[model samples]
Target: MTSAPQLLTDPFLQLPTATSVQVVWFTEFAGVNHIVTYGENLKQTARASTTKLSRTREDQQSRVASQNQDGQVYQKPVQRDIWRHEAEVTGLTPGVRVNYRVTSVQEDGKSVDSDVFSLAATPKSDTPLKILLTSDHQLKPMTAANLQKVVETVGRVDGVWFAGDLVNVSDRASEWFDDNGGGALFPGLQGRAKHEMTHNGVKTIYTGGQIIQHAPMFTCIGNHEVMGRFARTGSLNDEFDDTIPRVVAQRIYPDKSLIDNSFNTNTYEEIFSLPKSKEGEKRYYAVSFGDTRLVVLYATNMWRTPKLDGKFKGRYREAEKDLNNPENWGYGQVIYEPIAKGSKQYNWLESELNSPEFQQAKYKVVMFHHPPHTLGDNIVPAYTEPVQIIERDSDNIKAVRYEYPKDADYIIRDVVPILEAANVQLVFYGHSHLWNRFVSPSGMHFLETSNVGNTYGAAWGDRKREVPIGYQEDYVKLGDPNGLEPIVPTIAPLLGEDGKPMPYIASNDITVFSIFDTGTGTVSSYRFDTRKPDSEVLKFDEFKLKLSSLPLPPGNKFPG
Candidate 1:
């Protein structure tokens, strides 16, 4: 019998390129040497240990829940230092089977080897491509089932793109590593973790299935992935102090510098090596796979919220009246970035959009955390521009403070025009957790399929909430009570052969995901009822994408 390495987490694939793929794993100790051996089979292989860097999270803690002797659940804060190792294996033959494993040497020089895994590089440009698109998997009861179903429905996916909210709290190590509650993220992604969920006193165990171990995984930044640091250390570990940045920022922003100074998404920046632009660590990037080009945008404000946190009495603090120092100012400011002209992200995106690689590709798709258009409650805050300046109680018990924005949100005022001009066929986003699609006046497709986890309810028809006081007219002028415009008429209520809307495919409780197959030029939407474990993965909606029909620049090659 052979013993596996003392691995904290199983090896997962990240940043797969044309000739190399970065493999990452974690252990308990620093200074431990690790190597990744790769080849066509497990028997013959090449080894690489060319890079090693140690990371420590002293100011952060991982929070999880555990039951007491009396069966009462409470959060357990683990503040252990983490040591992660990443090794990039190069010189691989594209579109061919490759086997690999990670071996680590302990302080005593004893070597530990992980289980062997297999994968192939991303397919070449001329080959057909299959990609899984989903987002907002923040440890919901059904997240494990969502990733497992991806593999069950689509046998082999070239890549997986998560549109943000990967974890509930970016800085909580346990939420990412080992939350005892149903939300442990790593366990769900690697197929090694199961969630014990209790619904109405009925306990059920959910076994997570593998997804990233075999294919590369990529993600963008979401509001949940941002955190604010203040006061003492361990007390501010979870989403308690985290949500303050977002919810508070909604009402105040003393100055522009305060936004970036107070909130940070550095935790997400530390774990993965995402492709970046000339400006280092910019969350957005672009890459080409097969015949299509993907442009990822990180256009989300973690501190931007439409309302205050009502869960805890002290959660919304109005401790400061002047709002000068962030430490003294307790919640009520919308943390955001200006993505209009002259912004770094805007410049890089414009370059990517006009690049030869992007314009020449058969398909151009852009992914971001916020939905430029949505049929959900989130769209209200997402689309609203600040209009007045007044102040109220932090807990929403009082009237409110209103400060009008000097300009419109960059996405609505600027980004839309750029994307429409570039002829970007599809704009994929997921902040509002529902399944819906909209087409602009110029035939550009806008799709939101974030129903991968639990939904925040639909923002359409009867499900819409009353517009906040003083905003009714604004919403009515925008489109509807929820601010959603006309959905593509054909798929409004996607029907089955029975001519009825697909059963259990509504916004809430219905876990959903989508796959784009470049080979067939089709996008298929699948959904499952999280409440029913026996629910089948049903295809609810699909659309064929004809590159020739979509408007493209005049001087581009059309691959038939």
Candidate 2:
């Protein structure tokens, strides 16, 4: 018997062009007909194209109904059937709003419909906009509360700029569609989440903001979005942590396709329909929104366990049993894609910086996943490939370790110089889940406003990072690894236990969010303490993206 078709997520907007926008949704069964009904009277319709998700799966750890039965546990990753439907509604007038809803007809002849929502085409150049800046919402406990506060405080936003790390695991169907706890990506963003929080014996349920249903969202690739070598193991978590470099994978299995041997962002790439670069389809690209030129880059790498116990493969070394077998090595936090000097990504960025669209825009913003300046611990060990050093006692291999040279940090040594030279106004990123900002002498601003869910303690004062002792390369334990002073929040900075103003808001109970107002050229950050359910969302920091006074050097142009 064919199971009843059910809509998994409310319809959301994506890839808004000047005259059209894409409406996307998910369903459990392959429906007979799926479409978008738009306009004031909902008379017009556009048919949707449906495709099955390739690698989404569920394991014992999944929170789905089947896996929730008593004594029921999937020992291995089991494929979960999910179908994505996307319809392009074209012939829209720029800056005009229209009512829209999605409907799916089941194979059983039954139909499902979503609540009516509003949408619009890309805004005109003169149209002022407010865009939400957030990231690292890995289904953390506070994500629902954080998003709930956004709607209450800001009311409505035009767009959402997500820096990355949408969920804990990209291929987990429940994490994206319907985690029983209601922390799934779609539920949290479409006001369907049922996440609950308790304080002082008082329990409150939080439904995340109804933002994406009305506005479009643009995102970059974060470390969490990339899944490791295809599921060869029973545990999805193990496969996620088992990625090797493409070069290494090729050497081990020269006969196999790269996608089959190495890591991939297949699930992520399949979900969104964004503007593509000639070099990078959706992995990296640039888009023009209103008066702003937004350049998204793929600059994230595989994050490994920081432990050095020699029992597990980690950021610093290979596991003891796997050292002898070359195919099983983790390869020490290897980067997924190359963006160093002379690389394809770098060349594309150079062309984008010099292009008329970027140079003439009123505001220039570049976004990626890794931080170039931060007070958090993730910035340590440098943003470069790890150097391997193996120790052998006469015949047998004794130990294998990796080191990162600080001077060879690509983002700092190469990317930053080009961005600074291009007079890029803002650099937004989030790898460290904290709220902090820094300004270079050249006046470019770097902000990390990813304190949306939780935080890993910041590195300052007596607080330090977990760096291996006696390593050949010296790692900075405190402060920004690239050497820039953190900028204190302007309106209301958080105070430490010593009564001194701290430059960051790294709290699990208090969540932070930011909004960029294009009309004022200012990015404002706000925070809400979930402990106090009725507390006001306090505006903590505000900074303007000012055009630098320095001029491009004479006869010094970006090389193609």
Question: Count of backbone clashes for each model?
Answer: 21, 0
Per-residue lDDT for 496 in model 2? 95
Question: What do the candidate models score in CA lDDT, each in turn?
Answer: 0.65, 0.89
lDDT of 1 by residue, 471-508 (tens): 32343313323223645324435454567553223444
**Candidate 2 error regions (>4 Å):** 1-5, 66-71, 548-560
Clashing pairs in 2: none
Per-residue lDDT over 1-560 for candidate 2, one digit per residue giving the tens place of the 0 to 100 score: 85555689999999999889999999888989999999979999999999999999988778877666422767678999989999999889998899999999987689999999999999888688999999999888889998998899998899999999998888888888888877888899989999998999889899999999999999999999998888766677777777889998888879987876789998998888788999998999999999889999999988887788889898888889987886888889888889999999999998888887787778899999999999888887789999999999998888889999999999999999999988899999998999999999989999999999899989998999988888988888899989899999999999999999999999999999999999889999999999999889999999999964443454446432
Q: What TM-score, over all chains together, does every model reach?
A: 0.81, 0.97
